[model samples]
Target: MGNAEIIAGIKIPDSQMAKAVTELVRDTETDLLYNHSRRVFLFGAITGERKRLKYDPELLYVGTMFHDMGLFDSYASETERFEVDGANTARNFLKSYDIPERDVDDVWDSIALHTTPGIPQHKRPTVALVTAGVEMDVLGIAYHDFSDKEREEVCACHPRGLRFKHAILSAFCYGTIRKPGSTFGNVKADVLERMDPTYKRENFTEIIMGSAWDS
Candidate 1:
């Protein structure tokens, strides 16, 4: 028999396989990352509540938990961006449970586009909330949306390591530098630039000008 998902210590209700997914995330990610993922979920759920958006909380939890799994060696790929890898992992996890394809797709989009700005918010509530949650944790975007008490509560539960920004940035670099080509045409390219000084992404203007159709 498969191991039962744990929930005694978790603050959130273990809906469906959310506890299992959360446990997997904690096991796979570094402490800093795991805490960050948990905080993202809190921030996102709060935002969803504030906006009065109707969404599946468990789906959001699953998406946020797996959002950064691509950074871990077991899940990271040389060809795909970390986001895609994470999305694929989340998708597969959901499929194994015989989840509805539409719900699975929502989780996939949420994990894949968590880093993307402007677009995810236009997507479904699940996707949009994931992006908002991630942005709140990493960039502190819309930080004011939640009160000090709310922020303190989440942070208290998932203490931020000292120098969290630097640590997370370094983690991002570590995942992308070895696979520099995968960083091109996306936000991950900037991470490659900061970490590997010798790395340079292709210029879109040059590509457009050099295209055969330009003549």
Candidate 2:
């Protein structure tokens, strides 16, 4: 059997795979988005376990971890395209990394249709399960405080912390949850450009006020 086949048949070591993906995403200049993506992967894995998906847990984890790998390309390009290009990027990267075809398609489909919203109704059950978890992750991004046990709205590791607040603020500011065909590139550069280190905490509100990322 090939390397990809070996990876597919066994459980992937989380730290090892996560390190590689983290490096790849960090280099792409989407560190915070990458962090959130990792959380989505974790959430997806747990949801898959709970839902009894027949697929390998490792496959679900790895696939979801790299779902937004193409976000970098989308960010760099001028067209704001994501689905098709993101899938192509995933295909190429997985092929280069020797990922198995079935597992590859699993990730590709999930990434391609992630922002499509309505596409979930027709997706594979596992995809739908993962999607819901990812959505919750997005929803919990900036607003949910994990500390208040009695609140009962959302849950996360460090709710109400800086990371939690940043994510929540990001989701409210950068989230594109239900809208379809919303490309990050199509967004005005002035918006995301302001998200740079120079921007103040309150600047997110101004920058994202009328942007598609807020959709």
Candidate 3:
């Protein structure tokens, strides 16, 4: 078991299941995704610690590991959104270990809603933390929450490459493009918009502008 202080007193989980999932992700996804998944757990744990939120480190680690699994062909669905696919995969994986149904659902929700803003925060502590971690890594949504040293430590381990933003976008498209309809009501829809010129999504900005109450 390998553990490191991702933040002051917080250590990354390195149990057998953690190692197995890490290896599974590494073997299935590219370096960009492998590193991103690991960082998601680290960052989520950091936020959970900072907020003094009660959480299960091992379960959170599992959720984060499988959060993006749907992006790979092994788990991808031609109809369901990758998020749901990933969430279902996590649920199925944890069941194999006889994880309690309650905890399994927590991990499932964590992966399913990691991409949806504002809602995960209202779910289980682990789910909110998982969402926080993804937003932090992908969008720098709360980058300032961590100290310079903490940020650097995480970056050192995960090392967001020079083209990370673009790479993540490309990765999202790779997963969802084959099933573009899967992105219909979520942010993943933006990937289809960018990947396919003719694919237009419902635009909130336009909706607000055209609303009868405004302008």
Which candidate wins on lDDT? 3
Off by over 4 Å in 3: 1-9, 202-215
Clashing pairs for predicted structure model 2, backbone only: 141-167, 141-168, 142-167, 142-168, 146-159
- After TM-score superposition, the amount by which residue 40's alpha carbon in candidate 3 deviates from its true location, in angstroms, is 0.8
Candidate 2, residue 120: the lDDT equals: 55
Residue 161 error, candidate 3, Å: 0.5
Clash counts per candidate, in order, are 0, 5, 0
Give Cα distance to truth, residue 144, candidate 2, Å: 12
Per-residue lDDT value at 166 in model 2: 55
| lDDT of predicted model 1 | 0.85
Off by over 4 Å in 1: 1-11
Q: What is the Å distance of residue 131 in model 2 from its true position?
A: 1.7
Which prediction has more favorable TM-score, 2 or 3?
3
lDDT of 2: 0.50
Angstrom error of the Cα, residue 92, model 3: value is 1.4
lDDT tens digits, residue span 115-210, model 1: 878899999988999999899988989998788888887888788877998898998998787788877778888877887889988898998899
- Report the poorest 10 consecutive residues by lDDT, candidate 3: 1-10
